[model samples]
Target: MNKRLYLELENCIGCRSCLAACTQCGGHDERNRNYVYDVNPLVNTQTMPLMCLHCVNPACARSCPAQAIQIHETGAVLSALVEKCIGCQNCTIACPYGIPKFDTEQNLMYKCDLCIDRSKDGIPPMCASVCPTNTLQWLTDEEIERKQKQFNVKNDKWVTSIHLENETNVRVNLPGILQGITKLY
Candidate 1:
């Protein structure tokens, strides 16, 4: 029932467009540190856009002393209120990916709010909307689970990402590349 942001690690061009687009959202105002990049846990070399995972059981919300973090009706976990946020960084410490940020000037915790206004109205978030390679998608819970299962990593913790365009997910597996970091060609 929940919608999630899905990523394709291979499609990332390292363009930083997602980061640029993030600033266009409401309340960003050159201060919100929203979009962030993260490396895959399974593959050290692979990078992906990192945001609030909107966990079913969110540690950030529970740890917020002010209880400023809110869960949108659509299941999106939003950024903490600047007025209510104490800049304690408790959520930052609690987050598995370390995605939360502190704005020293504003003295508030900043994290991706998932473009709450657009998402509720059925529009994709800025990052996903501007992804030229279709590497990011907004998908329902069932769609994400089904796609992830296709990777056959249900037991191995391999995450499914991107447009599902190319079946090949990792580049290091090729025999020639295994010999060295250089391209096989």
Candidate 2:
């Protein structure tokens, strides 16, 4: 199945539109919700949008005593059953990426659903729709693989190897380099 938010960090601008969209999506006030955080690298200025990785084997889902989180059929999106959650925060602690945010006001944990509701209407997520630059594009696994293959052929390099190196290197040189590089969660 197609699952994964393939990010081109080099193309990302420091705009907080994605973050704003995510917060609004999660039913949080503009002031309180920050699903994505902006990071300024020592060398450059770029906003890295942070959100749940929605891993194939999600630590949050495994750790949830209430079994509130479930992966969609596509496997890219994850949703939480707020009613089932007891605000234990086990998912939050289990997540290594720290993408899940705890809303003390609501006494529930919220995270990025990858805008599945919007996707059902065949529209891009709010973040992708509002991105000033065409950096963040949502695509299925097959589409991403095709692009990666094309990129490799054009560059005369191995895309998978580049990705592997990128994944291990926590100290990225460019801004937003770490957007989807880590599988921490």
Candidate 3:
């Protein structure tokens, strides 16, 4: 699909609307898979959302001894299959971004699946749907390209760390400070 999820880090207002909406997604069991973090509590109140980037070659899936973590056709790395998951937690240790969450009681691993029920049908994920600041967005490739060009974002893929940079399905535009621009969409 041409339509995909996009993130504009500078636009997050720390409203936590995305978190609330995440719990409402089907099969989430009232738990939010994504996270919001204070960029710098002492320096500023800037907060950013973090979620599974859905790596092109997901370590989470690779580490699954039971092969429970499956990637959907849309490249969304889905949660561990209940029947197949062995509760080994290997996926958690293997992931670089620390996106997967373990349920101690249920002995299961769960993470953002890009709201497959909705996203697979070309609808926006719950978080993107409720974001008032448009921090999280569902946009077409053309729209993303236009925004990236407008913001002077040379790279559409998210940079996980200095040592390891994996290409991901979800595109991102870094904060203004990192981009050397005062405005970001």
Candidate 4:
């Protein structure tokens, strides 16, 4: 649990490797839980990976009337339990980053579970392991600190679009253009 997930927006090359790897995760039902987005499709090819930020007090979990979404001991906000899920779609609407997805046919809510099956044992998540550009990284606190210092980044925390109820577990280093902005588009 000492290792944390980290993202460097500038390092991503839009390869989609992380997305491909996500489908192979256990309990994922061959569906990719992560996403890659074009930073600005018209202007540049720079792409960024988007997944659950695993917020400290997740809105998704809070809004679930069935209380299906649970937070793991390792601080990962897990996807909804099939039996507990009520298909209310509250999680999809509550999340600030739009991370959760609802399967209409299956009547379920699914999001990034941070590969708990592997990460609980200190192994890197599948996305981080397959990222050839090192954009998605799994690192210890010490390594994260080193990278922050090396990049001259004052704060490693960032959010996409809007502020969440609290901070997220995952750390992100914004691209140079958005360095001080602290908001990811």
- Could you give candidate 2's per-residue lDDT for residues 1-185 as a string of tens digits? 43344555566567777766755553334433334444657856655655555566777888889888887765543556868878889988887777677778877777776676665454666666777765556666666657655444432232222342223111112222322343221
User: In candidate 3, what are the lDDT values of residues 1-185, reduced to their tens digit?
Assistant: 65778888888999999999999999898999999999899998889999988888899999999999999998889999999988999999999989999998989999999999999999999999999999899999899878867766446333333234367788777746565767644
Worst 10 residues of 1 by lDDT: 165-174
Quote the lDDT for 151 in model 4: 55
Clashing pairs in 1: 7-161, 7-162, 8-161, 8-162
Show the colliding residue pairs in model 4. none
Q: On a 0 to 100 scale, what is the lDDT of residue 65 in model 3?
A: 92
Question: For residue 22, what is the lDDT in candidate 4?
Answer: 97
What ranking of all candidate models by TM-score puts the best one first? Answer: 3, 4, 1, 2
Task: Give a tens-digit lDDT track for model 1, residues 43-120.
Answer: 665455666666645678878999988878776777888778988889888876577787788787778777888887
Q: Give the clash total for candidate 3.
A: 0
The per-prediction CA RMSD against the true structure, in angstroms, equals 7.6, 7.1, 2.2, 3.6
Weakest 10 consecutive residues, lDDT, candidate 2?
A: 166-175
Report model 1's TM-score to 2 decimal places. Answer: 0.73
lDDT of each: 0.64, 0.57, 0.86, 0.86
